[model samples]
Target: MVNPVPILQTIATETWIPAAWEDFLTFADDPTLVGGRFYYDQGEMRIEMSPLGSAHGRDNTIVSTLINLYAAMRSFPMQGFTNTTFRKSGLREFQPDLAFYIGEPGQTITFPARSNAAVNLNEFDPPSLVIEIAASSLEDDRTRKQALYQRAGIREYWVVDVNASQVIAVEPSKATQLRRSQVLPGLEIDWVDSALKRAQTEDDGAVSRWFLGLLTQ
Candidate 1:
């Protein structure tokens, strides 16, 4: 077998490579690709090996922070996972920028004992919400990844367009301009978007306080 690591390392980020599902899985298992994100759609596989830059990282942090804050303030049972892979053999897979199990599922979430391991789709249920921070991978995130999430039975999905500073929330079907969450009742998308915009300049502490106030009101 060819050593896939060096080849994978040389591939540019966000570039798609056509390979058999089994071969893609083999490449995915390589420990050297720890920070990379992977996707397998049909017979094509794409691996994003490039490191996340500051803007991407900032937006990711802001989004996760808002989710965590909302869950905490509302006493909504939720668990957040970052860069965790969700895989279904020979079909589809993704490592969402941020994923969450909400309500009963969130309260009762479980995973394998090993850290940084892929969550086998056959074993565990899909998350209530999956978020994609669309910095450079906007097209893939909106199209291919959105379809993949729907197929995986994800209840809600959000594509945070970093450039546009907008949140595209959707159910299993087509994407829509949502102002509230279907999965998390009473969680308003507009508030989330406002906080996201504020995060560009305001400190997280201030932004969090703003969220808390909204929850209390």
Candidate 2:
């Protein structure tokens, strides 16, 4: 007897074929796709096979830096993970551009000492916050992924619109649009947009100082 190969259909650029959950996992395990993001909702899967563009990378770095700086300034317990996969078997999975375990869970989140291991959702709590930087996939991030994150029970979700230089922060459970973070209270959403725009012209140190000024205010 011979094992059958999983069927993979390329629906669009950066989109994965719809397959069974187990099949999607098997496909995702390809070594070439390492560091690549995979998202599964029910039987549908989307894989980001190409590397992130410069704009996407820049926005990701800027936002992550701002979040870390804010956490440090406020003495808030928060830890950010870059492209960490969170999988719940037979349901949904996501690898957001950035994810954070905030507050008490943020202080204690840990992973085994293996390199490049996906964080099993079955074993760990979902991140308190998940952010997607939208350079190309803005609509999907705001609509499909928004509902998916809510179903996964993430506390807060952010869609960073690179084109508009805006951040859409929301409490997934409440389904409310927000101007401030619920997980990291007093952190204004507008500040993130400003920082992202500033980073386009200013060096990181200058951006940090600007954020620090905001924090002090």
Candidate 3:
């Protein structure tokens, strides 16, 4: 659930200056609210409140579980943890639905692993991959949010449109080059078409077997 605090609204108008920004940032970096939003300023952090409450359903859990298993089977040396507040593009604060640390976790100012086990945005080593489960927030997920992650230098971002049952993979490329998925590192992702194929071919039993096998393998 998101906090009810009006931090972001206040910041937008310049009604809140640097001093308030500092106070807010400090509040955000506090370890207590690790599962939600953490807004940042130059270096400080503040917890931003959201209207939605803690209401993740079973479908969310299933998707998360399946993705984790898929990554494991690929032997990527990943650590899959969900709903951790992260700083995106070193500017905006975001709580990815699920984020995977590609290798060993690293140290940072906000996430001083030694003193505070909180996942600090400043301290996040470049994540190999980040995934978002998209339902209603399709525009934000595919456009603004994707741009934010790309600018933040995320290697790969998978936006799973659950309603569509498809995954849109995004990554950075040179201005003169083509943009594509760098997570699978050259694999083609057909998004809608592939999802349609999965839906047409796989029954619930097959789908369960697919994920279970990935986890065990």
Candidate 4:
């Protein structure tokens, strides 16, 4: 086991560093650092202790609510989770800001609501969609996290750029950017972005109402 004090003290936040998967698990499971978001990519790990300030909190909640509304209105069966840990045993682990298990249009979705303690990817399927709210870690989100999820076989990944008010949605499998969500079919990325912008000025209830109108129409 790596010495917890020295490794954590010397390591930088939001930057990948060479470490064994075992070391990564040690720091990730450390009780004192429970609130820290953890990620392991191949042989490197990144620990981010982002402040859930008003902007991040607002964006996270609004986007999550928007997804719930859209999926419900479109009759798509889905389950949403906040800050769920997904561990792939020896390969990878990611605790995303938001995650969802989605079903096809008109398909009777029965995706199990796995353990909140952390979905062991070795046992259950990975989440269909994973979203990260980049309150201050946009570069890390775009590059490191992107590459990690891609290698881990995440279907759809979204990086919600809190500063720019943009949602960078992509299919890691196809290696292409997306305007419309593949898993959610007609859910437009920019529409979600617009809602973020609207959310800055308007209350969440108002923005939600606007999104509901668009969804119903």
Which candidate wins on lDDT?
4
**TM-score preference between candidates 3 and 4, better one:** 4
Best by TM-score: 4
In the range 1-217, model 3's lDDT, one tens digit per residue, is 9777743444532121344454654545645544445434344333434433222233345555554555455554556666665644345565667776654223221222433334655655645667776665566667656666666677778776666656666664321222344554323455222433454456535655755653465
Which regions of candidate 1 are displaced past 4 Å? 1-5, 9-13, 104-115, 174-177
Q: Give the TM-score comparing model 4 with the true structure, all chains together.
A: 0.93
Candidate 2's C-alpha runs over 4 A off are: 1-13, 104-115
Instruction: Supply the TM-score for candidate 2.
Output: 0.88
TM-score of each candidate structure, all chains considered together: 0.88, 0.88, 0.58, 0.93
Regions more than 4 Å wrong, model 4:
1-7, 110-116
> Model 4 Cα RMSD, Å?
2.7
Clashes of each: 0, 0, 8, 0
Query: Could you tell which candidate, 2 or 4, scores higher by TM-score?
Result: 4
Could you tell me the lDDT of residue 31 within candidate 3? 57
Report the lDDT tens digits of candidate 2 across residue range 1-217: 9865433443443654567888787657777557667899967888876667878888899999998988888777876899878878888889999998888423655542335677878877898899999977898898888888999999999999988888999998888999999888889998999998998899889999999998897
Better model by lDDT: candidate 2 vs candidate 3: 2
lDDT of each: 0.81, 0.83, 0.52, 0.87
